[model samples]
Target: MIDRRRSRRSFLKLAAASAAGWWASLSPAGFAAEREPHRKPIPSSGERIPVIGMGTWITFNVPDAPGPMAVRREILGRFFARGGGMIDSSPMYGRAEAVVGDCLRALDRPEALFSATKIWTRSTSTGREQHADSLDLWGAGRLDLQQVHNLQNWQAHLETLRERREAGEVRYIGITTSHGRRHDEMERIMRSEDLDFVQLTYNILDREAEQRLLPLATERGIAVIANRPFRQKALIERFEDHPLPDWAAEIECENWPQFLLKFIVSHPDVTCAIPATSVVAHMGENMGALYGPMPDAAMRERMVAWVGDL
Candidate 1:
């Protein structure tokens, strides 16, 4: 009979070796913890953007967090170093634009950025002026993309954005909707408007977009930017106790965060997923999703089951 202790030791060694080999196969970009890495191209424009980008909503809006904002400077530096670039913001996200501007100005690497912001307001003049203020705050001479926030007076704002695009003030213009509650409205805007990108919420838990918005975006040749990838921490709460699915190993997901992020970004129509993070380590793991094996449809279905209704 084989010695039980010896058998256990041998099994442990084999497991360690397997894990090492799996890590070796993963995209080294996120693992190195050195810089922002991983990029996906916009199908519509063929312009590649970092697969993982930052969102400056709650994190950059602290009333007295410029000191903390300085920490974000280091984070942005690391982002630029690792090949990350896209930074999405909106006037509604108060003070976020200013903080981002401060960071970018300090970094002085405007060329490395894929700057994006949204126009929010009913009046065309207010929207246009807000757009100009966003430009000033970001310190970017020409914005990369502009989206109408929630289609609020989108018609008027789209005209303003179009004029800006014509004047070389911005490169791309689009729209955004979240919570999956506005799918019908989002669809109408998507179908009627000439948009280059569409920002919306899509994840394993929130597949509403998959039924209509995602397919529509694909058919229309519009790029998709996935927001709320973690479902506002719902994913972590649901999966914290559950063991990582066995197949998750196939995608190099050693952690739940990586698993969720990869699942959202795996869709071919998804140009990028902007998962927000204030913690650097969390940012590192989120970027890891950008690298390594993305879930195939079958795997995604399994992933949905593994995290069902949770």
Candidate 2:
């Protein structure tokens, strides 16, 4: 019988080594230009960010217990070492925001950190309080991005977000939804609101955003942060027994994680895809998507059809 635990440890070791080797291969100029994973511009400001980013949802909602915190610290270390920047979390995610703070503190606070979190309450007063708590938890004087989680009382919170942005308390303001919920309302808000970003669930299997939301974001010049790139691990679990399509190599994908993430970030409208993982080895594999070649329109279609057949 296959020893799954042993296999996982071996794969993690190999992945870490491969990540180090990939970094060593880049030239100074390449590094300065940020050309390894490639970057996409935030449509509103034209500021570029790496296409692959880290997410702290369920993966980061850990207790203050030493062992669990150490694992999270290692995951954050691997993320920054691999050129990751944006780290998305929320007040809704239990202790995730606080855990992120702990991990960053242990890492001595990376300059590349682009912290993003959400205000997830109905009361504007509570939203303000929550936003302040998030900044405290993240140890950032000014948050890079603040979103309205699931569009909860977005109307009230967006006003405050705009005010904060104008005062330079936050760099960007936006809203979010997930699990394929509230697309119609999301679309209305996207049309009517002056948002710099939008977080939503989109992956290889969940293509509903492609029909309207993505195209509308492109038209409105809004940056898109794609969450659930692996559909909350459902995609991975579903395809665990299946082999990647032979043509996946055209995009330089060696594994399922890379294949899935590349599909999300390669879309024209997607500024970044935040894939969360508690495992350090999975972080390596996730960041690997940022390094390799990406798919074009034709290859993307093939990828879609290939996965659809299964």
Please name the candidate that would achieve the greatest lDDT relative to the true structure.
Answer: 2
What TM-score does structure 2 among the candidates reach? 0.89
Clashing pairs counted in every model: 3, 1
- In candidate 2, the residue pairs with backbone N, CA or C atoms under 3 Å apart (3 or more residues apart, or in different chains) clash, namely 37-290
User: In model 1, how large is the Cα lDDT of residue 196?
Assistant: 94
In candidate 2, which residue ranges exceed 4 Å CA deviation? 1-35
State each model's CA lDDT, in order: 0.82, 0.90
Residue 162 CA error for candidate 2 (Å)? 1.1
Model 2, C-alpha of 245: deviation from truth (Å): 1.8
Residues 1-310, candidate 2, lDDT per residue (tens digit)? 3699889989999999788667765633234335466689998888889898988889999889999999999898888877889999999899999999988998999888888999999999999999899989999889999999999999999999998888888999999999889999999999998889999999998989999999999999899999999987888898868999888887778889999999999999999999999998898889889876889999889889888999
